[model samples]
Target: MKHLVILGAGTSGTMMVNHLIGKLPKKEWKITIVDQYKTHYYQPGFLFLPFDIYTTQQVKKDGRKFIPKEANYIQKKIELILPKENLVKLEGGEELPYDILIVATGTNIAPDEIEGMDGPGWYKDIFDFYTYQGAKALRNKLREWEGGKLVVHITEMPIKCPIAPLEFVFLADSYFKNKGMRDSVDITFVTPLSGAFTKPKATKALHYLLEEKNITEITDFNIERVDYENKKIVDYADTEVEYDLLVTVPTNMGDALLERSEMGDELNHIPTNKATLQTLDHENIFAIGDATNLPTSKAGSVAHFEAEILTENILHYIKGEPLKEEFDGHANCFIETGNGKALLIDFNYTHEPVEGTFPFPGVGPLQLLKESRANHMGKMAFKWVYWNMLLKGTHIPFVSANMSTKGKHFEKMES
Candidate 1:
C-alpha cells in the first residue's frame, strides 16, 4: 500500500483528509495525519473571545473528533522531516515513511522576537489575543479593568488575518460604549502598513470607518521594542506611544520544524508555487494554509480555496497527469464594524474590493465592501458553516474556489 502522510491535523490538513478519503482508494493508499495537539481551535473565534462574543468552550474540541476514521491520526510532536528519505521523525525514536507528504504545519505567534514584549509586562499590562490562552487572558483583564489607554497594535505584517487588529479596536469601541465607559477609554490602532489595510480601496473604506469611530490611526509605525516599565512602545524612528493596556498581535512565523528541515524560507514558511500549491523543491510534496509562503492572505478562506485546488492536483499527480495551476489567490473576509453591523470584502490577486452584491449580481443577501446588518448575520452564521460544512469537506453552495467579477464595480486603472 502507498502511504500518504499529512503533517499538522489543523484546518487544511483535516479538510484534505476528509476530501481525499473517499476519492483515493483505501486499499491502495493509506492516509495518515500527524500533529502534537489534542485540541482543535476555531481560530477565528479567538477574535470574539476578548469581546465576550464567544466563550472558550465554543471554540475548542478534540482534534481527533474532526479527523475521519478512514485516516490514521497520530498525536505526536514532529522532531524533524527527512524529506530526502521521505520520512517524518517523531519526538521519540520513531519514523513514519511516506510515499507522498503534505505540509500543513501552520503559523505561530513570536512575541519574544520583539525585545521587552514578553518582559515584565507580559500577560499583565501587555497582552495578545492571537493564541487561545492569550485571548482568554485578555478577557479576564478586560473584565476587572477600568478604562484607560487601550492600544491595539500589530508587531509586523503578513500576520494571520491581517485585519484582526483593526477589528479588535472596532469591537472594543462597541464594547466600551455598551459598558457606558466609551468616553473613559481611548483606542489607538497601530500598524506597519501605510493605511488601514493592504489594498488601496479597502484601506480607503477602512480608514473612513476608523475616523468615524474616533479611533486614532497610527500608520507606518515600525515597532522597535516595547518599553514595559515605562508603559510605552517605541518605534525605530524614536517615536513612542504609551498604553495603560496593550492588546497586540505579535509577529507570526511558520512552524519551526520547517526551519529544522531546511526546507523553508527565513520565516520557516515553505516555498510553494502560488497557483499550484505544490512545494517548489519536491514534486511529491505539497504545502497549504499558513505553512506556505504565498503572497496571498494567511486566512481560512484562502486555505479553504487552496485545499480544493490541491485536492484535485494531488489526484492528478498520482495518475501522472498535468496539474492545474488554477488558484487565483482568492480570498473573502468579513470585517466586523460596530453596532450590530459588519462589512464584507471579496477579491483576488489582481482585483481590489468594490461595492457590489456577492454570489448574486443584482440581488445579494450579503453586500461587498459595505456595512450592513445582513453582513453581520452572515458573519455570525459563518461560525455554524465553519464547524458543520467546512471541516466535514462538504461543498459550500454558491461559493467556488475561484474569484468572480460579475457584480463587482472596478474603476479603470491608468497605465
Candidate 2:
C-alpha cells in the first residue's frame, strides 16, 4: 500500500486527513499522521483565556478525538524530515517512508528571539497568549493584581492571527471595565507596523476602535530588547516603553523539522506555490497553513480554505495530473472588539477588506467591517463550528474557498 504521511495533527493536517480519507482509495493508500502532543488546542480561544472568558478545559481536548480511526495516529516528537530519502525520523530513531508527504507543522511563538524577553520576567510580568501556558499564567496574574501599565505588544509581522494582539487589548478594555477597574488599568497597544493592522481599510476601523476604547497606541516601535530589570522594552531607535504587565505576541516561526531538513526559508517556513499549496522544492511534498511562506494571514480560516484547494491538488497529483492553481489566499476573520461587539472581514490576494455582506451578497445575517452584537455572537459561535465542522473537513455552507467580491464596496486605487 502507498503511504501518505502527514507531519502534524493540528487544524490543517487534521482537516486534510478528513478531506482526503474519503476521497483517496482506501485499498491503495494508507494515511498516517504524527504529532508530539495528544492535546489539541483551540488556539483562537487563547485570546479569550486571559480575561477568564474561556476556561482551560474549554480550550483543549484530545487530539485523537478529531482524527479518524481509520487513519494512523502517532504521538511522538518528530526528529527530522529526510526529504531526499522521503523518510521522517522520529525521536526514537524510527523512520517512516512515504509516497506523498504533507507538512502542516504550524508556526509557534519564539519569545527567545528577543533578548531578555524570555528571561527572569517571563510568566511573571512578561507573558504571551500565543501558548496555553502563557495564557493560563496571564489569567492568574490578572486575577489578584490591581493593574498598572498593561502593554499589549507585537514583536514583528507575519505572526499567527495578526489581529489577535489588537483583540487582546480590546478585551482587556472590557475585562477591566467589567471588573470595575477600568479607571485603574492603563492599556497601551504597541506594534512594529505603522498602523493597527496590515490592511489600510481594516486599520482605519481598528484605529477608531482603539481610540474609542481609550487605549494608547505606539506604532513603528521595532523592539530591540526587553529591559526586565527596569520593567521596560527598548527599541532599535532607543525608544523605551515602560510597563507593569507586558502581554506580547512574539516572533512566530515554522516548526524546526523544516529547518533540520533544509527545506524551509530563513523563518523555517517552506517556500510554497501560493496558489497550489505545493512545496516549491519538491513535487510530491505539500505544505499548508502557517508552515508555508504564503503572503497571507496565517490564521485558521486561511488554513480551512487552503485545505479545500489542496485536497483537489493532491488528488490530481495521485493521477499524474497537473495541479490546480486554485487557492487565492482567501482569509476570513472575526475581530473581537469587546463590549459584546465584533467585526468580520473577508479578503483574498487581489482584494482588500471592505464593507460588504458575507456568504450572501446584499443579504447577510453577518455584516463586514462593521461592529455589532451579531458579529460578536458569530465570533463566539465559531468555537463550536471549529470543533464540529472545521476540523472534521465539513465544508461550511454558502462560504466558498475563494473570496466573493459581489456585495463589497471597493474604492478605486491609483496605479
Per-model TM-score, in order, reads 0.98, 0.99
User: Residue 55 in model 2: shift from native, Å?
Assistant: 0.9
lDDT per residue (tens digit) for residues 179-226 in model 2: 999999999999999999988899999999999999999999999999
Off by over 4 Å in 2: 411-415
The sequence of per-residue lDDT tens digits that candidate 1 reaches over residues 1-415 is: 9999999988899889988988998789999999999999999999999889999998888989889998999999999999899999998878999988999999999999999999989999999998999999999999988989999999987899887888899999999999999999999999999999988899999999999999999999999999998999999999999999999998999999999999999889999999899899999899999999998899888899988999999999999999999999899999999888999998777777778998888788789989999998888988888888888888889888998888879663332
Best by lDDT: 2
What lDDT is obtained when candidate 1 is compared to the true structure?
0.91
Residue pairs with backbone atoms closer than 3 Å in model 1 (clashes): none
